[model samples]
Target: MIATLIKLLIGLLLWVGLAIVAARIVFALPRVQDRIDSTALDPADVGPLAATLRVRARGQEGKTGIAMLRDGADAFAARIMLADAATASIDAQYYIWHDDLTGYLLLDALARAAERGVRVRLLLDDNGTSRLDAELAELDAHPNAEVRLYNPFNLRRFKLASYAFDFFRLNRRMHNKSFTIDGRVTILGGRNIGDGYFGTGPAALYVDLDALAVGRVVPEVSADFDRYWAAPCVHPVGPILGQARRDGAIEDGLAHYADDPQLEEYLEILEGSEIVTRLSAGDLDLEWTEAALISDSPAKGEGAARREDLLSARLLKAVARIESRFDGISPYFVPGRAGARAFKALRKRGVSVRMLTNSLEATDVLPVHAGYTSKRGTLLRRGVKLYELRRKSASRTPADTLGRFGSSGASLHAKTFAVDGKRIFVGSFNFDPRSTMLNTEMGLLIESAAFAGNLHDAFDRELDGLAWRVEMDGLKTVWIDPESGEVTRDEPGTTFARRVVLRVIGWLPVEWLL
Candidate 1:
């Protein structure tokens, strides 16, 4: 029995050693260690799109026209409509694009746009886009459509092996989300391409926000996208995923599912939405403002980026310009010791620093919540006000609005903040270490008191009903329900099983990964 046990241990060791060797060999064989270069086409003079936008901006030079898309349905509609309207080029990049209702819907629009001779480019991080290999390959095969994967995994089938070999590089991701069409309009913010983001899916819904932008910012957005598109970490689908067999609907070039009951409802909602109609007519109600894009360099993933190229540095510069109040909204809030000290300094200087993030009960990524909990005491003790969003019901959400892709409002996903009630930021940046050091992020910093005040106002009024306040009773933490003035000693709406998961993950030394 002792000899048999020794043999078993030897066999396991041999297998593990062989697996590691194979993984490293596979990782080096691909373009993961190499750079691919490609040039992006200039924004075409897309007839009606440019003509109408030009008329609208006849007098507004060097200013961006921005419109808020707080409603999930409106955000979804805006993307679909823009895709359909594009006659020149489309550039879209995202961290997550689920293989669900909304994902397919948007892909269909892109494929249709490609059929009509429009240039379509889709750049997605390989991390969050599992089970999308076949569809992505098909899209890439299209003459007018191209797809690129960022920081991709070479061992597609054996992801574990890939991670084992290249965990350091794979850990960093491109978390930027932006969609530009005809080089004239762009939609950007916290939402990824997923059902939960748009309020539909089996997963819990995300409280999200997006901004449809045009004018001066569009060029900036396009230029920034070009930099990422030409980054060394990016790879074409052909080299990594290989060629896909053009079959089924893609081969036959079938028509869209306009008649499908699931898609029809959303089409009806789009027809009724004011965004698409006003956008096409050049009469969209957009606020003109001076907007600056803050983004991390594509080189950040390789740890070779300059400090000045980081989004955090740009944000700190922006924050330095603030005087009185600051409201930071992030679903994944993991303020490390450094962030705590910074906030403490801000507090000492009389800045009313407030933050809104997911509560334990409302957070979908429980591990992130664990990381956030570690800093709560430090932040609250240092005079930073914290609000945790509650898991909300679907009473306010419409079935048709989200379609089959909708979800219950169970988490906060919007990453935005108001600075001194004069400047506001909205984008895919989360206030966590991952966003700071492990991922590339982008957002618009608008110099508009009105837009910034809207966020501050919501925190004072609407958020009181949607979120609970986190306070400290000496050294003990408690949650206060603002609506009923009820205080709870433990996390609100959390189950015993979930608490166990949270505790287990909290004990793990994985704060850097969060």
Candidate 2:
């Protein structure tokens, strides 16, 4: 019996080894032929809207028109208006696009735009859209629309098996979020296309930020889209969905929303928005400033070894120029040793640094919270004024209009920072190792004191009701809520089971991936 058990164990090990080899060999084989002519569609052909925006931009003498999108309703309304107003082209890229209410509404608008002869190009990360393959292929069936995926897996059915062999390549993903219309206007920031981002989700709402930019920077954003659209890592959907198959799935899917009352109400709400009206009338409240659109090159993922090409490196150089104060906001704040040391060095130089991140009960990813808690003591000891957002909070003031109507819980997802009240950075670049080394990111750095001051004011006004201040009592840490003046020795609002899980996860050596 012992000999038979040993033989069976050996057979199992050999089978597993063979499976790994097979997976590697299959994934290594090229699944799609590289496009010979990798040229992008011309943005100059965009129509009269582009001409008007250029006239305005030239009037500002290279300064871009920037408007901060603080409210979720306003953000969603702005995108829908842009899609409706586009005359020639629309380009969009996102990390996540769910098939929920907001997602379908926006997609239906895009489909309508395509039907009217407007060219549409959509680029999405494969991992985020793994379940929407058929829907994306149907959308690609439109003659005026094209869909592409970045770094797709070869074996679509057995994704876990494929990951075992191609873990390194598949782990790196595109986390960019941007939308452009007519090559004239662009919206870029931390918000992805989903109900939670737009404040329509049934559960929690994400308090996020986006920048509506028009001017010379729009062309730069368009150029970035073009780069990604033409990269070798992108694969067209036509090849993924084989030929000789026309089932009208795309049309049928869209037809489901033809007379949707919810969609009609959303459209009505957008039409009545004051911001939309002002935008349509070309009377925008824009802070014209000299802004630099920074992005990591597509080659950053194609095995390029140059650190100079990294967005994080560029941001660090900007951070080095901070003179007095630095305020950072990130939902996933896993500042590894290097980041911690940088903050310490800044503090040593008499710079006041403050950060706002998610608390244990508020965070969606427990592993990330574990990594963050592990560094809480060191950061607090360094005199960093740290604040963690509460799971639920009451609205404080009129300026606390950062969420959607009826939003129950708030999750901090905005990635923004202010330097000495002189410059402001906003985008999808989280302060984590993954964003620093594994993914591509983009953002705008505006040299505007007014913008920076506005952000600072908003941060201050929302602090009392929205977050809990972290304080160290000798060796023990405490969370003090400013609104209620209540103190908690343990992680606030966390269940016992979750606390145990977090404690176990904290002991794991996985900070690099968090």
Candidate 3:
């Protein structure tokens, strides 16, 4: 009977192996199918918005006009206003476009722009758009609109199954986020298209940052969008999902949002907000600054990207320019052993390094908190200052008036760092192994002391009321509440079960993946 059981186990293993092999073969078949390729339109006569940008950018030939979008409500309004103001084209790409209220709002806005004859190109990473087939199809059905999915999975319903068979390829993702309009203005930052990122939905909202830019960097963003659009991995949704019927979902969705009394307050905020109106009128209060765009090559999506072509490599060069101070905020900050060493090196050079990340109870991804905890002690011992944003009730606080890029009672989702109080980098880059080695990322490296000073000021003043300073107490880790000076030995705001999960996860050899 034992011999029979052993034989049966062997047979089961053989069948499982065969099934994986068959799945791989099936996945390969869809990859070879042809898809459409396109590029951004030339901005010779991009109408009123382009003219307004040109007039505003007349003196600063090389500088980009930038306005910081610190509030979530303002961020949502800026995108909608850009869609309304664009006369020529609108290009947008994001990792996550949830099938929720804010997602539909933005989709409806984009669809409306396409209806007005403004070309709209939407590219989304397939991993994030799992249940939005019909919505994407609605926009794609419009004459001037097109949608593409990056590194898509063939399995429509069971996309995770594709990962089981082809984990290596699907593991890497396009985490880049940008929105460009009329080839003259753009907004690039950490926020994704979801109710959570914006100030809506059931969950607590994110305190995020986006730079509304014009002048030299606008074309640079447009060009980058074109490169990602024409990449080998992109598949046109029209061919993959078929020419989806033009159900009036997008139109009716916008109408619902307009009539919904709950969103009326937000609508009033948008109507009263002056950024987009100023953008159209060419007189927004913009800091003119020298900036350069840095991004990973599209090849990173396929694990074939070269070291020099990566955002990590370029980011290293930027950090090397740091002579005095470094202040940063990253939501998922999983600095492994090597990263801790890098921070140690920075400390050796007398750079005042400070970081603010999500506390264990505040982080959305539990495993990432474990990844950070693994290196927490090493960083503290090396003289680096660490602060963890604490969770609170979702109510308006002093931070609401302090230009807190992240609000009180919000998760830390913004990824940004300032160097030497004169240069700052902002976009969708977390200081983790995944961002360094797997995902394609992008951001702006700006030579603006004022902007960098804002980040430094947060560490010096604003965070005192908003974050807990983490310290090493012998072999025990302790958190000191910034506002109350209360001490805690345990991970604040997390339950016993959550702590167990982190402990179990930390024991696994998965730091690189985190």
The global Cα lDDT (0 to 1) of model 1 is 0.81
lDDT of each: 0.81, 0.78, 0.82
Tens digits of per-residue lDDT for model 2, 80-194: 8888878888899988887766776777778888988988898988777745566677678888888888777767666656678777777777889999987778899999987
How accurate locally is residue 237 in candidate 1, as Cα lDDT from 0 to 100?
Answer: 82
Candidate 1, position 70, lDDT: 80
* Candidate order, TM-score descending: 3, 2, 1
Per-residue C-alpha lDDT of model 1 across residues 61-130, encoded as one tens digit per residue: 9999998888877898899988998888999999998776788888888998999999899999999778
Ranked by lDDT, top first: 3, 1, 2
Q: Pairing residues by index, what is the TM-score of model 2?
A: 0.91
Number of the top TM-score candidate: 3
Task: Give the runs in model 1 whose Cα sits over 4 Å from its true position.
Answer: 1-19, 27-29, 32-40, 201-203, 249-261, 393-408, 495-501
Q: List the residue pairs that clash in candidate 2.
A: none
lDDT score for residue 40 of model 2: 37
TM-score of 1: 0.90
